[model samples]
Structure formats: structure tokens, C-alpha cells
Target: MDETASPVESADCRAISEVLSRVGDKWTMQVVVTLSDGPRRFNDLKRRVEGISQQMLTRTLKALERDGMVKRTVCATTPPQVEYDLTALGRSLAEPARRLAQWVRGHLGIIHANRRQYDSRR
Candidate 1:
């Protein structure tokens, strides 16, 4: 906490940090973007996400569900098919996530150049 910051501001910062930690995770934005298309089963999501392991996907889905950003439904069938989709809150995050990804893609060249320059200097 900064000396000049009030308690309310510190609390707000903490809350924001916690949420950011969830949304800023390596796989979170990717998962959110994939789900934006529509609901998908576990294996389908795993395939579309690319490079994500079954365990990691499971964890990510669980975390997203816990955060109210994802909805998980189980179909009452022979084997009980499970599907995951973005909730309203998750949908709200999709546009911003896409924009952020676009910004990163657009800036990759400059960002890489900066990183190279910084590394060379070091």
C-alpha cells in the first residue's frame, strides 16, 4: 500500500489485481476467445485451444466457472456430456480480450524490437 493511498483505494486495487490475475493468465484470454464462438465440449475446446493439455484445460475451465465468467452444463445422456460456454460476464470480457489480442499482434514487431534492444543493452 502506498502511504498516500486511502484504505478504499487499496482495497479496490487488491480486488482489481485479483481479477486481473485470473483474466491475465496465459490460457484465460485464449479460452475466453474460443468460447466466444459458442458452447463447446471439453475435447473440442482442448483441440481448438492448441497446445493446451487436458489437465490445463480442465483447470482453466474450472477457474473460469468459479469466477462466474463461464457456464458449465452437463447433458443427461448415456455418458453425460459436459459443455462449457461463456456467461454474460464472460461475453462482456470477450470484446476487450479480442481488442487486447489485436493490439498485441499489431505491436509485436515493435515489442520484439524493444525486447531485442533491451536484451542487447543488458
Candidate 2:
């Protein structure tokens, strides 16, 4: 019997890769996290996710909206206000994202030590 993991072209491999490719993007997770609290206006999101540029936030929110993970609402007002929140799918994803966040926090010290060791060897 032959035993080996499937190549990237395999259906499962490709699917997992596609999912991770989007989820692993730095901005996506931050966007999801910030929106988890409740609907937030554009400026609010920009402020909460520090270091993110206006252009990047717009692009990330758009991408998340396209993926069905976020809902964007525009209200008519003096100038118009837009708010963002997680859709059902996005909230579901947040559970895992939150878990991952906790895991990173818990393991940060060990992770940093490992990185130092690896870097020092080279």
C-alpha cells in the first residue's frame, strides 16, 4: 500500500490552501476582530485597528464583504455614514479566530524563544 499526503493540486489541499490564503492575511483577522464587538463606523474601525492605513482598511473591508463575512451598511445623513459588522458567517469564524488569538497569547513566550534560537543558529 502506498501512503503519502496529497499534492497541492488535490482537491482537499487546494481547498485548505484557498481558505488559509484568505484567512492568513494580516488585515482580515484584525478586521474580523474589530467588527465582532458591534457595528462600527469606518473611522472607528480605522482607529481600533492601529497602524492600518485608510486605503488598507477600505480594501480589507471590501474583501471581507465580498466573502460574505461582513455586512456594510450606509445610512443617509448629512454626509452619509457607513457602518460595518460581522455577518453570521463572520461571527462563526470569529470563534476560531478568537481561539487562535488566545493560543498565540499563551504561547508567545515560547514562540519568541524558538524564533531567537532559530535566528541565532543562522
Candidate 3:
């Protein structure tokens, strides 16, 4: 650890960094928010999340499922059906995620302005 870094602070930073690494993905948050509404079949989720490819959606869903943030169910019909919903733990993240989304939308203009100013400065 660096001299400036305490063990407790380093641990907290590592944990926060790990979480952000997981949820910091663009599609992850969108997928979570979509599932927050209700359980959805794979195709429906793909459609609702616009711009995500079949493979990308599949990968993101699988990762979320692996993280215990989402549950996957398969129906036993002739044409098998699959649906995904957030686990209780996953659902608990919705409010903070929603607030983050809202904050981004709210500040995008300012962000763009800052980016332009920074770019011009460089």
C-alpha cells in the first residue's frame, strides 16, 4: 500500500472499485432497470434495452445471474420459455441505480460543456 493509504481505506476502496467494475457497465444498469419493472423474457429484454445485440444481451444477463443479482427461470413448454427477474438483493440496488441514472440525465449538458472546455484547454 502507498504511504498515504491506510489499510481500512484501501480495503474499502478495493470493495467499492470491485462493485463499480461490475455495475459500471453500460448495459448492466439498463438491464437491471428493465428487470426492475418485472420479469421479462430474453427477447423482450433485448428489445426494450435498445442497441444491445443478442450476444451482448445474453452475456450481460448471464453475468448478472452469476452475480446473484438476477434470477433465470425456464418454462417447460414445447417451445421453452425463459424469464429473468431481479433477486431481492438485486432489487435493493434499484433506488440507487435509478438515482444515478437520474443524476446523469440531469447533468449531461453540464458534462458535455465541461468536456468541451477541457478539450479546448488541451
Best-fitting candidate, scored by TM-score: 1
- RMSD, each candidate, Å? 0.9, 3.0, 2.0
Writing each residue's lDDT as its tens digit, candidate 1 over 1-98 gives: 68899999999999999999999998999999999999999999999999999999999999999999999999999999999999999999999999
* Candidate 3 lDDT over residue span 11-83, tens digit each: 9999999888889899999999999999999999999999999999999989989989999999998899999
Q: What lDDT does each candidate get?
A: 0.97, 0.89, 0.93
Between prediction 1 and prediction 2, the one with superior TM-score is 1
TM-score of each: 0.95, 0.88, 0.88
Give me the runs in candidate 1 sitting further than 4 Å from their true place.
none
lDDT string for model 2 (86-109, tens) is 999999888888899999999999
- What lDDT score goes with residue 14 in model 3? 94
